[model samples]
Target: MAQIGMEQIGVVERVWRYPIKSVGGESLRQADVDERGLVGDRVYAVRDARGKLGSGKNSRRFTRMDGLLHLSSRLLSDADEPVLLDVDGTAVPDANGFLRSYLNQDDVELAREGEISHFDELPVSVLTTATLDWVRAAVPDVPVDERRFRPNLLVRTPPGCPPFLEDGWPGRAARIGNVRLTFVRSCVRCVMVNADQPTLPHSSDVLRTIAAGHDNCLGTLATVAAPGAITVGDTVALESQDAL
Candidate 1:
């Protein structure tokens, strides 16, 4: 067995899923993990009338993704209903309806083509509390929260480590019970980080600091090595691999 860190850490918090593409996201207490990613992560995405993939990268010219939010998930409540939330609160009918109201009909087309109903960029995204505190100390002016990074898993780890040190965590696999995740690449920050949580106005310079100090505040992207249910307070184990 490869030697791992001495301290143990558990998932403290989680947040923000892009149900569609550039709209908005919702916070979750717990979620399911599969090969594609967290179930219902980027399940639905919006596209223009011309069938082009509407994303913050290009469509920022015509539509402001920061102004809207899109979220979805397969995990349901005790009542067996979809857990949905809009910019307003935890009660939106569907992703399309949310976009229809948030963005005028002229903008939202037919749910975008080539978008998978269960597609997500990564299996899971994690941010360490230590990294958040470091950023807070480094940039006291900016408000750092789950909304800024939109991570699926927020772990409370030791302090003073380099931002997104998880990128270097290879051979080492993080386990939450039967579920295991392999650390992938460092997430690249973008304008989406500047968008406010709710109707709040966007804050400037936050992404700039992230880009300058940290590697765009993306922390790290992870792939599911083992699929299983994850909940808060579950013991997280880090097993080092020989790769490094």
Candidate 2:
């Protein structure tokens, strides 16, 4: 095996957690890292009668349901009571009722019965500011906020590094403070990225740009190799440089 060198790639710029699937996320200054991901991330999910998790990826109950993105969910009362806030920043007392009314579906239910997360792919989603900028340049007309991509950790890549460089990072391991993460696979782009978080409108150009530029993939899914606390400004280092 060729010997690899260790270098400071970047610092954790931001952290986010989505307590409920298909709902808005809460930004954080620090988070407890675990095998499942940042604690409380995707800990709950809205379920349909058929038990399908509510996700924009579902394309059945959640497609064109960008309205869910406009509402932010945060743990307020307790783990059992995640408060959903509206665009106006008003607290929603009845989460299921508000969701039912907004989704216009009566068969859906909020569930948090077990420890298993409702993640669509792997536990952790990692993105770099360099890649975010690349997507913005690819589709200048469309707004590209990290929220649209729903990444758990956003790293600011080293200066002068090329964009979308993480596309080649699958199977690599990243070390952030006491945590170690193994990059599992490239995250596939979907229509969810095209949905505007503020206006909840769908724009085809976002996904189109990713498809044309990077084969409909950006970011990466990762699993925890070692768990610890991760904070903003923590230095990130790639521990392994294996083939993608």
Candidate 3:
């Protein structure tokens, strides 16, 4: 069997969690990681009439209701109740009404997914600054923001390395802080990447560039192997396959 060599690749530059799926995410200095990924991440989602979780994939619901991205959600207190905030930072106590008004859809409902929340694929998504820089360089016309990718952890790769290096990390194990994660597969790009963020307009070229340059994948999906706390500035290192 081929032995995999491990090395220190980068530091965790940013940590983000989305209390509600398909909405804005909140940056964190530290977070608890468990089998389901970062605690309180994607704990809630809007459900449509067919009992489908509202997502950018189902363009009929998400595209028309894309305004959900303009809203921000936060989990408050020990109860972990999600509090919705409008663009003006005004508290919206009525989540259903707020979603209904913003999405302009009467059938949609906002609800919690409890312990095992709704996830499009894997529990955690990881991205590298190197990959982002590469995408920006590949598509100069469109604005490339990290928010468009919605990654859980943004890693700052070591200096003087090629972009998309993480593409070869599948089936590999990585250690971030005290937590260990096993890479599952490349995260497939969706129309969500092309959706407009706060001030940025929707640019299809973002996904187009990814599809053309990187096979429509930019980051890697991972699952937690060990539960622990992770914070910004944490060192990231890949585990040797032989060590397993």
Candidate 4:
């Protein structure tokens, strides 16, 4: 097997957590990492009457529903109450009522994550500037923002590295500040990337380019091997499991 050695790739450029699945995320200056991932990340999801969570795409776990991307969710009142906020930052008093009307479904309601995982895949979604740079180069016309690809931690990889550097990190363990992570696999691209956001517009070219050039995969999904506090400037390092 090829050797995996300790290497400093970059520092955490940004940290994000989605209080609700498939909605606008909350940016963080520092976050407390835990086994489930950054504390309160994807802690809630909108559930349809059929029990599928509302998301940008349909699957056994999620039902593709419009308007979720148009609204954002926030955890307030000590997280006992979660509210859906509009573009004007006004909290829709009745989250479930608003969801029912906005999604055009009678039984849709906002629910917290329970036995079923709210995540599309793994706990922590990780990305790097290298891949974002590659996306820019591949489709210059498309916006190459990290918001286009939601991640818990965005790494600013060292200069002179090629794009898609995280593709090779699976099965390896990484450290960010006091937290340690084990890369599970590369994150597969989906229709969510094409969904519109506050400043980002809907674009199909982004996915097409990834599908054609990078096998429709970007970033990495990781599990917290060791938990602690991590900040924006935390250093990221990759090494073998033994190094943990």
Q: Tell me, by TM-score, which candidate is best.
A: 4
Across residues 146-180, which tens digit of lDDT does each residue of candidate 2 receive?
A: 98789999999877889876776777887788898
What's the alpha carbon RMSD for model 4? 3.1
- Show how many residue pairs clash in every candidate, following the order shown: 5, 0, 0, 0
Candidate 3 ranges with C-alpha deviation above 4 Å: 1-6, 59-64, 114-117
lDDT of 4: 0.85
The model with the greatest lDDT is 4
- By TM-score: ranked, best first: 4, 3, 2, 1
TM-scores for candidates 1 onward, in order: 0.76, 0.89, 0.92, 0.93
> What is residue 33's positional error in candidate 4, in angstroms?
1.2
lDDT: the better of candidates 2 and 3: 3
Q: Which regions of candidate 4 fall more than 4 Å away from where they truly are? A: 1-5, 240-244
lDDT of 2 at 140: 78
Candidate 2 local Cα displacement, residue 163, angstroms:
0.7
Using lDDT as the yardstick, the better of models 3 and 4 is 4
Clashing pairs in 1: 20-44, 23-69, 24-69, 24-70, 171-241
Which lDDT tens digits does candidate 4 get at residues 1-244?
A: 2225778888999999788888887788989889999888888888888899988888888889876777776665366656779766688888888788877899888787888788878999999998999998988877769988899999998898888889889989987888989998999999888888887889999898899998999999999899999899988888854675
